[model samples]
Target: MTDAPLPVRRALISVSDKTGIVPFATFLAGLGVELVSTGGTARALREAGLAVRDVAELSGFPEILDGRVKTLVPQVHGGLLARRDDPHHMAALSAHGIGPIDLLAVNLYPFEATVAEGRGFDDCVENIDIGGPALIRAAAKNHDFVAVLTAPAHLAEVRQALMQHGGTTLALRRRLAAEAYARTAAYDAAIARWFSSANEVAFPPRVAFAGSLVQTLRYGENPHQAAAFYRTDGRAGVATAEQVQGKELSYNNIADTDAAYECVSEFDAPAIVIVKHANPCGVAVAGTLAEAWDAALRCDPVSAFGGIVAANRALDEAAAEKIAAIFTEVVIAPDATAAARAVFARKKNLRLLLAGALPDPAQPGLAYRSVSGGFLAQTRDAGRVDAASLRVVTKRAPTEAELADLVFAFRVAKHVKSNAIVYAKNRATVGIGAGQMSRVDSARIAAWKSAEAAKAAGLAEPLAKGSVVASDAFFPFADGLISAAEAGATAVIQPGGSMRDAEVITAADERGLAMVFTSMRHFRH
Candidate 1:
């Protein structure tokens, strides 16, 4: 409440992440604050030439139970939780041979990291700290008298506050206490979420999800809204993707990059996917990265400008050369060859991200979206189309080549927005229309965009000619089916559950187009 600082008499320091611990302990020791630490922390401090009282010595009991029961004793918690303002609390602390612990710096065990490394369940369980959370909560609860530090990242500010105000300020203590609570809460939540997921329980009676704040962005989708990026503690994905070059990624860049990456991951072959505004502008799979990039670019070279590009394989010089000529915002791949790296180096403002490997799109996980009232959480869209589930809905059956292209477009359609239409030939997207409200309009737009893109590239023939078409959902009316046929689509694929499916299939038959219906529908919004 007051702006006054709280003087430190004694501090407890234990950390799994020892970053900047020695300097911090030395600074506190210089301030004449008695340092009490447990096990490894005590040994670390002693080795650093700083005198530290072992928790065993202070508690008058040796650490037992594999060094886990050292700091859970009443001697430590009583010192941290006692109220200095209350006479009874002070008398109780004194009667129990407990000295006041004015500060607590503790970092919990790396359970999240252990789990991420594919460690066995027993290893992960052992890494979850019990006493650490207890100490953090006790000191944080008594913030009026005790200052707490939960992470090594906060050591600098804590030490600075001590130097600036002769000790930690009440405001700083309150802030650190809030942070400490957050750390423990998120730590527990991560463990719980992991358990729930591993146990195959999608939703437990009580569920909590947590992420560590990675960075504060310049703004949200727009400049008017503030935003921050958070990532799972140790799991690596697009959220934790490292930018190897270029300017710091913007909010839109991150979103588009993720879209591109996820789309590219749908392919097993060497593939390239270009994304703009979170929609796949182009997608292609080929024998070589260079060929894939070229075919993907041919889908819509104009839209590929300033787009995010993702590839499933390591980028090669051949692919990098083609990309170097284009103005792209980001390139994401598993890795890059030396030649590729050299080629990309010329484009300093182009961000290159090495994701190590593509995240499995089929991996079961939760996806969240915020709504005005609250939020909507659902399992990720990992739908797949197989020949077993494919039905020939029209009179004309698709050829082997047509079926392959139809399947390719169908996979790409899954990444497109609602009312999506994708046209592909030779496992490469030729044109795409996404996010349209009307299904017929999407079909028409796909053809028109194909023509426009062809003209931009100085080609007289539109790329959609004789291409296979895929719709994310079934056509409600014959108009949508007729539109795709009119665009020179030789084959059509969609989930056929519409009331007017008969009319739509009849239209496809009239146009001499091979039509296949997939039982599963993928409607991305």
Candidate 2:
């Protein structure tokens, strides 16, 4: 059976944001409902010529301790929690000289905004609302009897419901109650995350996560799953990127674009990364953005179809022309030239995003994954190693050019899913193998991909010929080491930690392969 509307006898209003409080309270007053409020809300309502009863008067206790002890009094909660249908509860409320509160319009203090502004710790502590959350929980718990309104956006809807049903329907109360609880939960999460960050706690006693919904996508990784996009409180990446052109970004497009953008941020020079299915198919750095785009495309032209491209620098007309030739899904960069924008106009379906400068890979943050019953959180993978940190484990030291290529491959390996193998020549990835179960299989797949890519390009030799290889983790056996050597890889870089490390190093020595030990792994799952 459908729920009947509940009549409103009185409402308590308090809000940090006074966007539409007066008009709402006036409407409630017009319905012969008494208006009760505190602090700024009472002042605003009374200034608007509405007869408002102060909470200090209702509780018969003035707000004390800098206005912290106002609404915690029993008079406020007793009225909200009492069920009108229960004769004993009504008698108890009447005996205490307390009137029922049928509606609550309250919004919390701007705690997240205050923290975002770089305020001091004391300022943030003060902005944490005490009475607000208490009031919201009380009203939400008694949702069957009291209507709770948490946001200013809900004001119009509540007004419409009131006007149509002559009060708030049970359905409306339940919906608003759910929204209220979500608001308080997110608020608490933000506060918890802030404390964890401020205290430099890697694994807090309790993990807290929060985000605001930016958009509701058409679907998720597949066509059937529902999905939405949310931006974190402080960080700005692809989620905050501004779309200047094209159709709406799909779930895959957003995911792939983020992968492409993050990969490009690893390079100091002008670079471009092309991603397909959340994996990097092509990555290259060159003197100019146009050259980078061309070099990256040469890595895997067949797999570049409808791929997402991200450039570290601003996109120019020359790069735009090259990207427009292909049926690409999206182009993300700091900005686009006027001529480049004109070129993209022809491909209106292509998405163009301006994400400003690349995000700092060293920034500390959490990476979360949801399991069946709980979620997992870990620090982001921001490890970096350079030539100075390289330790040559084998007898042969890598030549300077091979060292550059080894570092390049290692950086690309960091973005690929493990077990990962990357073959790079110069500053461009020649071949990539990712997400294989065994490391040896990944090595074989990389060589095979290199051969296929060479054949498709109508080249005489494989792209990985004379290229350097980078393994995301240690080579568990000598077979993986021999596979890279067999594919014409002259040098290899890996985290040297395995039970058969000596055997692998001996194989590299026999093959005359130069190997460097980073002693650091980059595993993405």
Candidate 3:
């Protein structure tokens, strides 16, 4: 085969992540590809003794405006955007001392990391590089003639292609261009989201967001449909969801996973939350994961079957063995031990997810719901109901232990579909009522489930008529309180923003029930 003409003569390299940069740049240099770098990258390359030219030198202008105007000039962009097939473009570039830039290795500044550190808004805004994004976009838009590299992860592949072909291939250029565009898109989305959230502005009229698929599920809700999970920048939330191991997540699996993750993320201690069909079947906190799993299992054994379980701590061997005895659909935790992995080996079909630390609760994200016309958008419910924000409205106040369970029940109930009610004796949920048309019906379902669980566990009384109850929303009428009171809920916790809050308080008082007002409503549709 005859030698192919080199497509890439000049290259501009700028990056925030410097991993493998030296080796990649060295390889490009050996191929006689001119290297132009900016700021820290230029310093690092020169210190490594590689023949490197500063971006300012190639652009024929000093980096003005505090280094923000380095690569935005025509000298840099003309090289990247010039069409190799056009003689006029080549003539213009030759006259202007601009050579066709075949390879553009560039990554933007760490805007996301700066914002995540809780830095001032001005600091984050300053970290957004203008010239970096411009160069990336220019190179990506002209992928037919230019190669773009955005991620350090692609360094090895690009090096191999360059070494094997004596230059990067057109196919590789196209692939890297796609990735470069995706990187800038996601970066822009993050900036938009951060600004909107900080300013409390509604979604922009023209909002564009992008994320990568984390995994494809076995099916969506049912075996016939399709589904997948996507994560953005490996952050928290449903979009940032990660599946450590399992058969495949379904539509219902994703829904339940969201519910399970939300509930468990609220607790700071070692806790277990068991979710079935987007409702918490059981939840518990203890000194150890094993104890937490046992207490949660004892809450509603029957409902826990094939349910999604989420824990706040690492899964231990004892907890894994206990969980293996039941037919669980999924089990998630921060981490798992080797012994725990061995125990779970017995239940090969059960999904095991190792989610690291939960995402920051304050970060904002869009909540999407499918509607008849198109879709409805709203802000995700990232609010937390803390004990300090609650008030005891009833004549009696809940004891400390009861208060702990009450708080746990409230958090669990928030993720359950409305009309929702949750019952808990210890930290574990005994029964849950969800997606009912009537609050009274939800209360009844929760009470009955708890009773059944108690009986199966051979306890004389499951809830023992003193278990706490949590309502996701305010009691619109006193009848719901009456229902929970009759169902043996000794204490009730709910958001007290309703107009008829006095009536609900009266009903609780009449039934000798302790009621606390959270001043916040958690309505999951």
Candidate 4:
């Protein structure tokens, strides 16, 4: 019996990234392990002065069909699938003169990157490496005996273990195997999604995307319910869905945070949005985050209680201090300064999230909605509205400043629930009403919220009637317009696709309200 454990005597390595290949191959050679590679990997190892066997030589077949046929033959897979304990497996390997592969290092081609570059379908299809995925899956499935490395970052850990133990441990093999399977799964999902887009038809029979839960919240929309946060693989938004500080996220906390983030993401300037009950109670843009917070807070001081606040700019000491004065449930920003972090330390129950920026709106993905018996699927509403697209249907056209605020309000309203009405003045929401069965009721709720905030803030009066109003969708009747006008709204904006558009426009005109039709519906259902 030798003191050394069973070493990785035979290894097959293929990779798109060649980083650390020379040193890794040299280390393997020193261990008396036979290195087998294909194409560029073989050339690289050979140039590094290591004796590497080509896959063709081991398989006894040439790579045919423009390199697509490499590493798919029985000899390549047979070496990986053979069992060390079973006599039949051993006999089959011996009869075929094939050596068992103890280690496989493979990474798939850059299919996502290639497609992202606006490559044609043919280019994307060619970039899909079939052999690489097969090798990875085979090695991962037989991980009890074989070590499979899919990510280059794992090279150091795997190499150290191999050097120390003279063989990969079962634990390391299993961990690497999990990563290998994950890599292949994500790769195939990307391919399916791409094919679906290219062919204009659903791929994989039914479209499904996978996301791992980053955290389980304390509760759902209510404390009695349950909720969890999931981070989609390869998604760049929301700081990878992390909780940097404060208490555990509640069900309502996550929903409000999402609402706040969506509102703040609409503006390019320094902005702040305060959300309560999945609706924006206050939203504002200013020269600095502190100023924006002050303006947003001024929108609805009372309703801002226990609300979620999100800012586009870094949270500074001044802004954090202002936010701390109120009873806020959460505060999120791209980053928080050291002084800002210090302020939050006092508010132990306030959840702090630092998501750097918004996600790109054009990315393709699925949107899910749960129903009574099943779930519904549709594409995300990533559409945007431009100010120039607005048509002033009223006699009095909206001014430039009003137009800007209208656009801002429209975008914020899009994220609010149905029958949504957002009251914005100077890029700040003075009031918001959402989730009401009647559009007029939503408007009244928003107005009432603004009035309550004004009283709490000791302002002589709330925002004047000239403040803009944004509706998530078209108003079915003029009642909503009349309610907004009575509440001091001077300009209104909404998607003009409703059958009663003329009636709503007539109501706005009767009140001397400047109304614009965006021709874009933003119904959040």
Q: Estimate each model's TM-score.
A: 0.93, 0.90, 0.86, 0.82
Candidate 4 per-residue lDDT, tens place, 81-171, comes to: 8878789998999998988999998888888789878899889989998999999999988877888888777778879998788788888
Rank candidates, TM-score, best first: 1, 2, 3, 4
RMSD of each: 2.3, 2.9, 3.7, 4.4
RMSD of 4: 4.4
lDDT agreement with native, every candidate: 0.89, 0.91, 0.82, 0.83
Q: Give a tens-digit lDDT track for model 2, residues 1-525.
A: 237888888999999999988899888899999999999889999999999999999999999999878899889999888888889999999999999999999999999999989899999999999999999999999998999999999999989988998878898899999999989999999898888778887788877676778899999989999999988755656887899999999999998899988888999999999998888999999999889888788888888999999998889999999999999999998888899989998998999998877877887788889999998888889998899999999999999999998998999999998999999998899889999999999999989889888898888888899999999999999999899999889999999999999999999999999999999999999
Weakest ten-residue segment in model 2 by summed lDDT: 231-240
Best-fitting candidate, scored by TM-score: 1
Winner of 1 and 3 under TM-score: 1
Error of 4 at 123 (Å): 4.6
Q: For model 1, how does the per-residue alpha-carbon lDDT over 395-440 read when each residue is reduced to its tens digit?
A: 8999999999988999999999988999999999998999999988
Model 3 lDDT tens row, 234-299: 555344545566677677877787678778878888888888888787788888888988888887
Off by over 4 Å in 2: 7-9, 22-34, 43-52, 198-200, 232-234, 243-245, 334-342
